[model samples]
Target: MQAEIGLIGLGTMGSNLALNIAEKGHDIAVFNRTTAKTGAFFEAAGALRSKIIPCTTLEEFVGAIRPPRPIILMINAGEPVDDQIEALKPLLSHDDILIDGGNANFHDTIRRNLLLDGTGLNFIGMGVSGGEVGARHGPSIMVGGAQASYKRVEQVLLDISAKYEGQACCAWLGENGAGHFVKTIHNGIEYADMQMIAEIYGIMRDGLGMQAKEMAPVFAGWNEGRLNSYLIEITAAVLDTEDAETGKPIVDIILDRAGQKGTGRWSAIEAQQLGIPATGIEAAVAARSLSARKDEREAAEKAYGALGETLKRDAGPLEDLELALLAGKIAAYAQGFAVMSGASGDYKWDLPLPEIARIWRAGCIIRSQFLSTIAEAFEGAEKESNLLLVPAFVEMMSEAQAGLRRVVARAATAGLPVPALSSALSYFDMYRQGRGTANLIQGQRDYFGAHSFERIDRPGAFHGPWAMNAG
Candidate 1:
């Protein structure tokens, strides 16, 4: 099949992705609400622009592309996706492909897939990451849908993706919603990672009284170490630059209000629904919410007055603390993955978690050295669902839990809000502890309702009033 792609919504990510495809020598038909944006891409790409057909109307966009046409939707998630699908439905035929390349709720993706099933239109939920720059270059792509449909466009996707061990950055992440689910959790992990960096920044600024410029080298140095990641590397660059207008640090002058498009929140909510504790991801969500409430927090702080002294800079080694934080973050990510894995089982997607982790190692915001370890754990597992109990990961968590606890304690003492990271660590501790307060509540329920509690010894067998009376 000759590669001809159609892209809707010519925003930052979309325009870049479209340009990347065009640069790679594929015919691309681009559309935007405002036709001017499409022209901007044409002018920027110049002579290579002939490869792209700019369309203003939905009908024109659909008509311009070839049959079995692959349309990449880069619009905002939620209603915009629905609106685009509805608008495009009339123009599409059987066996046509629609790819959502935005941060959308996985459940919605599953719902949309089911809706389009008999219509003969194939829906692909793709998790695209690497931000604007990565989109223009090559970003890690996670795709989930019909394998046959994936195979048809695999080469095109590969051509536009970042490389990994001679394998394409794109993978058939399973059926229906798996791609978006992995992406959702990816954003969740991203939330935790960013919050961890922020916490580190807080420690550096508040504890060490180091300026952003002074801390930039420390992060840059860490980037060369195991802590090296896209986020950390970029953060160092961000720290190095200053705003010309403010003369103050660029980062400091920027507003504390963090923006979200609800993917992280969706992941956390889905985890709760699936009975999975995604504490790290949830903490990240909470951290963003807290960031949005800067005024409220300031008021509360002012009312409380001076509470305590600054943290004493101990001459102790921070290697253990860093290790513990890394482990806790890893556990949090594992828990989030487990939630998605469980959803896959229930949704019948049969997603390969190892591949999901491996693909996330580059071009994605949450890309980190830690994902390699996760991929290893998933690879060694007898079953995909057995990721959390993998021996190496378990050992790593065990080694780091103590340090994580200490770090959380220190943060709390310093009156710093490390909600996301701390919550993730707490969730990890609770998951591994083998006993939680919830179990006590369950015991109470069994005692009151004759709900038939199983002894730890008996395991799966249920015991009720009949067994008690007989005994």
Candidate 2:
């Protein structure tokens, strides 16, 4: 069947995604704030230009696409998404599909879905990942909206999405904002993983006194082991490169500071409001902030020279035990997913946690072998809520606990900060511990306010007489 897709932005990602769709035999109509951007796409696609019609106005763009028009918005995440939706509404008919393909805040998505309820326009909060190249080829897509609305456009999405074992990369995540919520947490986990990789790089470099070139082989070897992943594989490539002119290692020459676009921070903030522990994500954000303090760190390093000692290498090979590190990383990812699970429960989204893990096994940043285990954790559980308590994950945590302790202790002893990795282990420990010190504070609340508390000795009741009198 012929499908006509409208693209409202021709930025790097939009342009590439449009091309990918066109290449897949679907016709695409392009529109942009700047007409020139759309023109460039038309010129670049050449003969494929026949598949893409550039429109000067949103009205013309909407008019050009087929009925029940599926328009994908690839604009900036926040206010810009709002602006585009407002501009497109008057031009769109009821029951038309509006897909937000940007990194929009999930809360805003929830509000927008409600706002468009009476308009008959279907709004889908879609999380598209894999970046520009992924767009040009295939990316992992997370969609959240009415199931019927998702079914309406699933074919088009499937054609453009990266396939994994014959399943479409696209899945109906849940209702309303669920898609973007998963994406937000996906990005949060991404931040943690990237920071952890950087920490490992730092440990190998500063702590081990290994050059970037020297480190490439180690990473490459690790990639062949249980720690194998796209990130580790790419890290090997990153370590191998050197500046042609300066003959200095590329990684060493690059700036120490890292930049963030705010999604990770937003995830942490949401976790706090929801009373969920997102320690891995929080550490990732902290790692970025620490990166921004390069000058202060350099100064301190100079002032405290010789006081710091280098890391001592482990006596023997850890080849057989690399699964320990892998297991800890899996627990970190599980904790991140647990945060999303909590948010979904609170929002009444009914998200499919198992499918989320399955879709994430490819295209996305956290795509790793461990995700299969996470998917199994959800599937084997009696209820979806039991994912964290699954036997496999619990066993993985148990196996990794000692290695995590050793890694954290070694990093501390060597004066190296492994914030993301360390915090991930801490989160795993805390989750398994089940009981928290915060209950002491809750006890104090009952003591002072006469608030009801569940009696450890018996059951639930109002504890203090003074609290009952105050009430």
TM-score result, candidate 1: 0.91
Look at candidate 2 and give me any clashing residue pairs. Answer: 95-120, 450-467
| TM-scores of the candidates in the order shown | 0.91, 0.91
Each prediction's total of clashing residue pairs, residues at least 3 apart in sequence or on different chains, is 1, 2
Candidate 1 — which residues are off by over 4 angstroms?
1-3, 314-321, 381-388, 435-439, 446-452, 457-471
Clashes of 2: 2
How big is the positional error of residue 320 in model 1, measured in Å on the Cα after superposition?
4.9
| TM-score result, candidate 2 | 0.91
Model 1 lDDT tens row, 1-471: 233889998899999999889888899998998888877877888877778888878888888888888999999999899999998999898899999999888889989999998998999999898899889888999898888888877877888887666665678888888888888888887887788778767766775567999878877887887677888888899999989997878999888899998988988898888887778778778889888998897898799974464666653325544664566567667777888778877878887888888887777787777777878877773754544577767676777667777777877887766776687677666666766677666666666666666676766846455545543
Q: Residues 1-471, candidate 2, lDDT per residue (tens digit)?
A: 223888888889999999999999889888999988777778999878778888888778888988989999998988898888888888888789999999989899999999999888999999998788778888889999988999988988989888778776778889999898888888988887788778777766767777888878877887886677777788889899988989998888899899998889888888898887878789989989888998898998789874366766663214212433565567557667778888878988878888888888777767777677777777773754534577776676676667667766777788888887788677766766767787777778887765667766786575665565654
Weakest lDDT window of 10 consecutive positions for candidate 2:
315-324
Deviation in Å, model 1, residue 134 alpha carbon? 1.4
